[model samples]
Target chain A: MTQTNTIRVLVAKPGLDGHDRGAKVIARALRDAGMEVIYTGLRQTPEQIVEAAIQEDVDAIGLSILSGAHNFLFPKVVELLKKEGADDILVIGGGVIPDEDIPGLKEAGIAEIFTPGTPTSRIVEFIKENVKH
Target chain B: MDLIQSVLNGEKRGIAKMITLIEKNAPEAIEALKQIYQHTGKAAIIGITGPPGSGKSSLVNQLTKKIRSEDKKVGIIAIDPTSPFTGGALLGDRIRMQELALDQGVFIRSMGSRGALGGLSRASYDAAKVLDAAGMDYVIIETVGVGQSEIDIVKLADIVALVLIPGMGDEVQAIKAGVMEIGDVFVVNKADKDGANRVVTEIEMMLDLNTEKDAARPPVIKTIATTGEGIDELNEHIKKYWHQIANSNELAKRRKERIRSELISITEDHILNQILSDKSSKIDSMVKDIYEKKIDPYSAMELLIAPEK
Candidate 1:
């Protein structure tokens, strides 16, 4: 009855941000760390991201946005997941966002935020620790 | 039971959760498969396979849009390779099919091949069944960019379309003998690129070598998957193949063959798993016995398989 446990994470880019290098980096990092990562390439809407997360049945969704629209876009994805009754999917963010935005994003249900120069291992570790089964 | 009911109710969440569990081979999968198997065997499964960097994903996207225009519901299973070192995978096929992600009529799932060498994970076949039981009109599977011997898609799909792109290599290397022999339909994607016509000619030349005179030649269609060129014609060719097979009862024959292979495989897995994992059978002791040469491996297998006999 024992089956292998696989951690599935969706690495996505939301909004007008054309910057996807960060998302790709985290995706490759997560994969190299033994997690199945699905990368939805650039310019995904919150709705599309949520829909994909549901279909993929991923344990966590790491939303990477550098368009300075993180405040609006991050909460929108979290809200849509809640609306779809899939809020159990852990939502996290990473990018070039300023220091003032972390607390607000965290309050909006984002589990954590990784800013510039953070090692990819920390993000991978955070996903493994926070996945809700 | 509730998940089964929800899946039957066409709930996406339910279907997705069930597919994940079935892929993992959880205990509940057996009962669920029993309930769902009867609901399957109706949807057409089409496999789009080809070499790396080819336009298989884009073709799937366009074909899906074409099917959706007819008001048919579609389910897509796109498989990608897992890294051997980390047992992890990056399923990026969805990036090319982004337009279909939010469409209510389409359900797209990306799967990691999970060490299966035949271009598909075992979970992918089960996921296709989940989609079929959930009432999809067509299920489309896109295999990881394939090479020779990844032709496993041919055994499961009702129709197999082998896609090739120009400028990859000489025709001999590009047209792998293992895959070239099985395609029901052929595609020259990126037809707008240079050397497109040469690729077409090479396939035509290859097809002419077949000695099966009664079999109609599979059509070779040219396509530029990015700009949606020649997709309508490709879809028509696929439909024509389906119609021809259905009229000849070849569809039933293929399904019967598929079932025969699948049943044997499932039974083999079950017996081998039980034999190796059963502690009460003294599997560990048998290992020690073989190591000490007290029993040969073949005798050990016979003893494990039928102790009383």
Candidate 2:
């Protein structure tokens, strides 16, 4: 029997960031790649993103944070997910983060960071290869 | 079994996992649901639907806050459309209720319509079941109410609130007939906008015309979701309707009807899958025969269903 499962992903925009063009584009691209993408819309808090991820039972969470608060916010999401015992969920960060910030983000439990100009296909491929379930 | 037990214990992850299983149509989903079936039917399932810009999400957010203030746990399912071409969905409804994310008493999920019209994805019903079993006092389903999908809400929810914003002339005309029949309560959201009372009047007139002597006419309440105005009144009406139905046979009848519909739908999907699965050769031959006019579509169907018969 073919045991197939849909790759459920939540694309969230965390913090006071109002820019969602990147998030929306990636969400549409992921959907086009045959994955179910739940776009949580603009201006989401880290707590909200984690809560949504847990409730939606998503395999991965794609955070689109354009604000400079990634250091505080991204780690907060990772921390919340861990506290809730959902550390198994794959976490990826995207949008306007410096190269130096990437190391800190990954260290904070973000599995991958995709900066600007990264094609949606790369993200899609990565998710397909890395989804835990 | 562990997951089901956790769901019954109101564990967020467990409830979420079960909803995901149902959405993916997992093979174990049926058995899992069966195990937790006895624990469901406790929460009041409320359906809120309206046009694209009717502020349904904002209204639901306000309603959730009110329900939480009364010390009730809430489960929310917001339905968004799936791209028929791509089979993916952009579920953005939960954004409006982000403030409730920190509150452990609230659980919100955004569901893709998954090609099932009637304003709900098939998985939504099961998600509600999971939430109900999780001991939520209310499970709110918010859907785009413009089309035929809204009718499905009346079947799944104990109370259906039809939300309309002022100045949506075409929207009112488009959904008036179907919505008038299904809405238990009519809400004029964005009441701060112009012509709010006109929309209310229009709904009242329709309700007056359609209500039978024995049928209770649905009350029309004005609300501005942005400012949380009139939500209390709307909440009261929802509670009142729940009370009226709880003591009456209507609740049981609706649940029975929902089960019947769900069974038929599942059976239909199952049989269709069976016919289509690994039967490419059979289907190709049938198609070729039909294209050549050697067999009609009806004859082909009969042949396909012959074994089952």
Candidate 3:
């Protein structure tokens, strides 16, 4: 069953990553899945991403980081979300994250990590299943 | 009436509504802006722009913290790319600056480029005006930073910082001529990267070569925005530029130019819309005729512009 309100997502690239093909692909996939997605073009800071999520009243925030700055960037985003009273938002990530770092990311409150090759359907389904209206 | 009053009182919903109205070019929004126009001019607008990978958002986050430390209210309007097919904005930049969301003194808004020719959303101008009228001490307009169109920020900001990063191959050449010319302050962000000094030197050389008699030579500052290094100096430079603009006649002249440009844009849009609406069928027929070579496009245009005989 289709939900009455479309889930809003803020998909962003953090750090100096110039590779945004994945971000663009995901943004398109999410839009195709009947969600409203805001794609911050590239080189966003954690602060800018979170600010956008809150301003757009997005239900989820997805960050794509490939610049090897995930260790520093993800935690900062989680911290900012907590401070902003937006902990309710489902924070997810995708990029060149290693499997070993996934645990630390989860521990830091990132709801999920969808690596490269993860199906867009899975992302849509995960949000549909987890995000509370 | 309530919308106008609420906007003047700085209500968020009211401000949002006014922006929507302005974006649609609604008459009421024009009236509301007229009413609140006198209350503006208090906000110091800073434009953050650079090549796409220049870490502008991170720099903005650092700037936000520095500004907040001074007990000033800040507003940020980040322009994100809109999907060509779906008309949706992927608001990725806002996620980078989430820390300030909880700050009562800070307000952030993200806009979609929405296929606008100028790389900025048409609504961005009105949104900035709304933030200005809402009593923000500082308003930062961050563009997607793709060349020519990104230069629009110069018209909207009191201080424009052009951010650059090392390791972007041929960055000096990649930098748009328009953005290079408009930058009031140059920032070599991600300065911890290799060849950071080289980037700074290159920027300095460029600045030296480009300095004009009438324009102040922009300073190039090295910053590692991620770690907040050199942010204070950057902030100080921004303030100094603001003060310089305030103390001189340049600010007034700039504002006049902005208003003039806005007027021209509005008139153009209005005339185009009116013409399209009034002669939709005729225009379609003319287009079809031109496509079939039944009439030349120039004569069709002449007929369209000529009053009905």
Candidate 4:
């Protein structure tokens, strides 16, 4: 069962993406929206991301990827979480992902994928509405 | 039982899940802890606390690497502050610790203060317990030292290392009152910067003033966490301090006091939940009366906590 009130989210920059500007902005947005945000920083592996999500007890995992490995890394995180019985954590992806890959990522269990120019408010709203609190 | 068994077997997922359960204060957390408690008390818990920007996280990262090099399994709990108004926290300590994220022997978890007044989450100690039960040789708790209440780390860590840096005005006096007695070791991180020796001297003088006859004074060391300089020395001091306290009655006393405080905190929360949830309880009326000045808070408090009729 989920904790009452606050929603915890893990904002991770995974798979060798050194550009953390987007991740940092989203992290601050989530914090300002009254959700606890754990930023795992850049260069995190998919294994590390899922493990962090589980330990932080995040309601959602927001994967910010830019190295063209979203196809490989994004689904790997969802796969690992599911393998560990943590499919309950809603997984979402963002950052430099193409529209063509969106369907594939969603099919791989990503709840939603936000591309560049997506409003922070929409992300916050989506989380508030979707997190299994 | 499955979780506990997996944790005992050093399964990373199991340890991670159990720590999450504790952080959420889920009902199953209690059951999990009951089973895990017996396997704990083996890991040497170290507390690394300092003011924000004092390089506490970097120091922990360096120390974790050193400990891992010695073939020791390490568990890290980094506690970041939560906004009182929003109940939100940005836990970025893992940024500095990214180097160890891939190490199988190093498990790092970032925890929000969760509005705990003491600069640590209520579940920090329990999370450390989970790591200890999972067979970690060293469990380091890094707290965001936001002045005053950072002393709470003493109750949870076997050795408390207070991190200090240069150029912070009155650096010694700022933490001296609230943190002095709690420190087992003192560290001057970012030692390559100017005024590092001054901070070291100040702490040494403070320790001298509080020295007890025949008691081991808290040792202070200097380090540049970014370059990992003096990390070996810092690790040596940590091990020395742990060795000195390991067999002492002081260690036992500290653990006992920790448990006692935790029990009281748990009971206080439980009673508060009960008071808030029972619509028939007089607490609501007492609060209204107090607000309207029909009764003073002291008298209202008595009525509010009085036995139910």
Candidate 5:
């Protein structure tokens, strides 16, 4: 017999961004929504984030970058996950990313980028709907 | 068979997949774990447990680095608690172990206790076996911040290191009965802080009180995990303990006891699953009867068992 499955996600801050309020909020919100979230603390590199994701075997990686490094940081994580053959992990973004950067990020394999003021429920629903595993 | 073969071949992804399946209790997992069990008992299993903010993760990181210096593979199982209400957990142990993630020789997995008591998820036992079958030289299980009774680690780990930091007063009374006896090696981490020596003295006093005069007393070592101080000493102690136990029949005795308990638990789960199966007549209607007080839980359980027994 099988049991109800629990989805695991990784929440990370991949830059010199010191403030982690957004990441903590999403982690807590996901916990409230009944998902396990692995929180990699601040100042993690793209390589570190991706490695944690694979080791955690998470269904998704939620990257929060406020240092304006989404251009370099977010895509770098996605690329690393790909190189490791873990591209199936849903990659999403949040924080102060600009509208102009969202398209480039999507092209780079970020499924969605939630800018400021986006509701936590949207992130939860996006994960619930998009997580393949 | 391919997945089992991959695990035997030491592929990281395969081990990861096996652990995930085990975590979910997938139907294939029991069969897969049964095969994997043949390859276990080779790796050195160490369990570390202490109170919150006791530097367990940092100490584990240091110990891993030290072990890797010898060119051995290490598998880390770090546990955290799950919120009972939401069935969710924020597993932040990896936050202290980020640097070790990229080390191919090091495979670290975080687990939420999933409402398991005694500070570990039940699946951690199978996950440790997966790592062992994959040929890791060392398997380190770090428990969630533990209290007195969270000594279940002793059953799984060949040796248990109970890490304590300075500044928590009344330490002796805190772990007097529960974890105090379970620890094979006591570490006073964050020794740079004040009162480290006092904590050491307190532990020594407690150890001196142990009446097993023939047994080796667990050593109390001081460590600054952030700087990797005293980890070599701790590693040496762990190795020495292994050597001592290896030369005797103690290791086999411990393993036999461990497997016995594991068998009992797994069988109990299987029986319980059958009783709690999705058939509406089984649990759902019984739950309603219990709620309505038409039947008490104990009698309902007897009734449920009556038909089969």
Candidate 6:
């Protein structure tokens, strides 16, 4: 929509969770869908994620948290981005998020939450449709 | 074109743009680097690596300050982990050295690991070369402190400083033998903490046990990174080691090895990209077969290379 060539996305895993099969799958899927995805690997902190988003000038940040520390980590990421005046960047999350906690996460400025079974196509479409730049 | 020319002339923004281009893995970036490659190799490259919570960023920040105090321009590449979902980076290390961001003499860039195993990014060596050619007095690379994989830093830096903090518990013991051997200097940070001395002693004992008879003994320095204690002494020791290496031809030998390593890494990346982008139906069918277990990965690879065979 913004006339950009590719939608740049930063896919990160926060805290100590080492499982990355899902993350890799999503990255490959996004790339296949003509998006530019920068996979940061595992064990990234909130600060590292924000700094990367700033430098990469990405359109969206997708945090995959399976470590149950989402409450602690996601807020910090949002806070840092806000502090850096990067609030315009879309923030979304996935990875074992519970149904009960979705509202709280959404209230914290997360644009969307995709669960484990969500199709990669749907994710790609959502990003392309919603993210302006 | 002017940007590329300025990069060749060793200007700061030009260097930053070159690194950004390289990290993007753009086609033109390679040409830009080739143009500037010959001007590289003047700066002292030091790698600061250790496990998370080892205070590597703080040490790098302090070292940058110390290096600048002596009127030396510094280029720092702090590698952060990339985002798995979005394929971006959360570069927290920049937060540690935010003050340096405002300094005209210091250039700091945070690079994402991009999931490249062995602790270093594929473009890191090239980026360092860009900094070196940019006329920085020193180039410091800080890695994400992830055990043995982090030892890859040794291949890129003239001096490798391993930072260890107090109260890491038994995690310190889990550092691989490869990491233990590559350290040219050891730092015990957070010296104000309770177990600082014990960590220092343990490192000393480990050094004594593992080092060769002819190898120079690596010095361990203690520091409270938050307050900048012991940083000046650490800088002095690092310079002392650098002078010794320069005078002994060790620096030249190390630089040769680093260049060789960079060539190998770049070639590997090129070959892999080529293989993936070759656009042959045979490779695709082979991958599908491998996924279906009709053939093993080794056989698939062999089949993919059958044209050359």
TM-score of each predicted structure versus truth: 0.97, 0.92, 0.74, 0.91, 0.94, 0.70
Candidate 2 residue B282 C-alpha distance from true site, Å: 3.1
Candidate 3: segments with Cα more than 4 A from true spot:
A1-28, A33-54, A57-133, B23-28, B171-176, B292-294
Candidate 2 off by > 4 Å: A1-4, A16-18, A41-43, B170-176, B278-280
Per-candidate DockQ vs. reference = 0.80, 0.62, 0.16, 0.53, 0.76, 0.05
lDDT pick, better of 3 and 5:
5
TM-score of 2: 0.92
Clashing pairs in 2: B118-B149, B119-B149
Global lDDT of each candidate: 0.90, 0.86, 0.80, 0.85, 0.90, 0.79
Superposed Cα deviation of residue B178, candidate 3 (Å): 2.6
Per-residue error (Å), model 5, residue B246: 1.6
- Looking only at chain A, give the TM-score of model 4 against the true structure: 0.95
Residue-by-residue lDDT tens digits, candidate 3, B19-135 = 656655567777888888888989988989888868988889999999999999888888866667765555667556766655767777766676675557777888888889988
Can you list the residue pairs that collide in candidate 1? none
What DockQ score does model 1 reach against the true complex?
0.80
Question: Candidate 1: which docking quality band?
Answer: medium
User: What residue runs in model 4 are displaced by over 4 Å at the alpha carbon?
Assistant: A1-5, A67-69, A79-86, B171-176, B279-281, B290-296
Full ranking by DockQ: 1, 5, 2, 4, 3, 6
Which ranges in model 6 have alpha carbons more than 4 Å from their true place?
A1-133, B170-176, B287-303, B306-309
Model 5 / residue A91 / CA error / Å:
0.5
Tens-digit lDDT track of model 1 for B4-115: 9888877899999999898778988878988988889878899999898898999999999999998999999999999989989999999999999989999999999998
Per-prediction CA RMSD (Å): 1.6, 2.5, 7.9, 2.6, 2.2, 9.5
Candidate 6 accuracy as lDDT: 0.79
Global lDDT of model 2? 0.86
Residue-wise C-alpha lDDT for candidate 6, range A1-133, written one tens digit per residue: 0111346678888899899888878877776665667666678878777866665567788889898888788878898999977888898899998999889988998888999899888888888888854
